[model samples]
Target: MVPNVVQKGEVIAIDGEWWNSDPIKVEAEAKLSGGAPNVSDAFTINGQPGGSYNCSKSGTTNFSVEQGKNYLLRIVNAAVNNHLFFKVASHNLTVVAVDASYTKPYTTDILVLSSGQTADVLLTANQAEAKYYMTASVYTTQGFYDKTNTTAILNYVGSNSSATPIGLNIPEFNDTATLVKPCEAWLRRSIQWTYGHSSSLLLQHIRCLYHRLSFTSPVEFNYTGDVPNTLWAPICGTKVKVIEYNATVQVVFQGTNIFQSDNHPMHIHGYDFYIVGEGFGNYNESDHNPFNLVYPPLRNTVGVPVNGWVAIRFKADSPEFSCSIQKFYKFVKFDDVATTLDVSKGVLAERVPVGRDIGG
Candidate 1:
């Protein structure tokens, strides 16, 4: 169990969902097709499609709140294959925690969460005494998605429950900037940890490691730009990168346009790495743009922006075998390989199972 770093008022749990019609039948077909999975019938909140959905009004999830009180909204995106943009009408959310790690309170009007990511946000019931719609919609650059959004109700104490809740405006289905803007604030670690290294050490050591990994790329074209038809077929195999214990490891994940330009959320088990830097387009190692080594946000999963890249750093201290893989795949096939961290004294150690064996 995780403990809150700051005051967590009344806690309210919320989660994103994907309503399916005959999930078993379609899942079987999706695996065989080697293509994008079938789009979900509806986006839901806590299993209910909400009032906006046809025949779901009576089952809408509603929460009663008193004015001047604070409620902590713990939201998790559990959709099978989609990122989400969530918001409450007329209320700004103060993001205090993410992926079970507390972050310095950063207020934003919108929240973007990729699958398997969790955010703890504080919502002050300071708005007018009325019913407000809490909604979640798709945040993707992909062509296919569940167009219908999910909704719930934030009913202030004594507000008319029968009243039609005021709805909130969500971003356009494919709005990439809105999705990235919320993350620009760069959530900082609320508490300091001693694992961070000096910038000079990072450049000298991590740069050499990155140089070795960069060459592993089959052929570098315009990574974030158009890809030739010949490059659509991905190279698949098992590869392991051995690192020394307590060594700082930095990885740059580049999102390519091989099949379709889209965001990829990468996750590494058994490690909460610092998200040092990220930007659109291919990452340049010598750009000299500084990484936030001082108080970077630590997360186990990070979303690589559509046609972009992200750099993460972590201390490879855990002796256990760990794997890193993309959390969601739409355009890509089931060709992802598990990159393991076998931290031993220049020798491969015995592998132990701790996370998902996604690479088969």
Candidate 2:
């Protein structure tokens, strides 16, 4: 039985898995940087570097959930890097909200979220078992950055239980469209809002915030295995996306890959916007126009396709600060500035970075 809460229940997931079994077991690289042996040059969870090099240094945790109780897990990917897959063993997570937007109740064994996305899941401990394992692992569409499988114990009070953690089907580290892409297409916006469909009249007044905050993947270091090259750095800037208050805004993210081709999970700070359009190759003017303004799935964070692009739309009606974070596979990460920037009272925007161009 799903609870009734308008604009309060949506679901999103995260995956950025890596762990150092041995802190000093860095692999010698063909590239000039981060080669030989260095634990500091690795992917991380929370903030600590992770590696498959050391098994004794794992960061598994323990937690308890009372039986017959309904717990809402507000999961957030505040990490500046990597998308992650999360789930509780033997429990069907009922997703209720995503990025502060309410969504229809949907159950699944595993949930995938990119960096900066949030999912509010209702955990109902209805099973007879008294213990389970909650897991969060790396989700890679391009290549593996880390394979850290962070686990936590879910123990129920006042009952019998096993010492071993229960098993779950958290999607494989590399299953993108196989396990992830369908989930991305499955999310639909709530029906409680006014005008469930977008009208062309409303579409004509679209305030397109079209600008390419472009970054390219390098081609110098190509380490192909399960692990991606831990050498080449993807460069980006601290961009402030300024928009209007109480007005509809749409933004497109175009991705480029030269060295290593990968996908990016773009997250927002304040509100869940409609994921109107997305595809491969560059986002064109004629082809990508006239978006699916008719009740597209709304999410705070969306995936900019691997070596492609994604377009999203939302209204800057909420009076608060928000952020748009861009977490590329091994390179770029953006700040959580806000969902919409209110530059009213004749104030337009923060000083434009010199040599920067505003296309919209």
Candidate with maximal TM-score: 1
Judged by whole-model lDDT over C-alpha atoms, candidate 1 comes out at 0.70
Instruction: Please report the candidate that would top lDDT against the real structure.
Output: 1
How much is 345 displaced in model 2, in angstroms? 6.0
Cα distance off (Å), candidate 1, residue 223: 0.6
lDDT of 1 by residue, 119-217 (tens): 988888888899999988988776677888889898898888678898888899888778877777873222121111111000011332422433244
For model 1, the stretches where C-alpha displacement exceeds 4 angstroms are 1-9, 18-20, 187-218, 330-337, 350-353
Query: Model 1: how far is 9 from its true place, Å?
Result: 4.7
lDDT of 2 at 22: 41
Give all candidate RMSDs, comma-separated: 6.4, 10.3
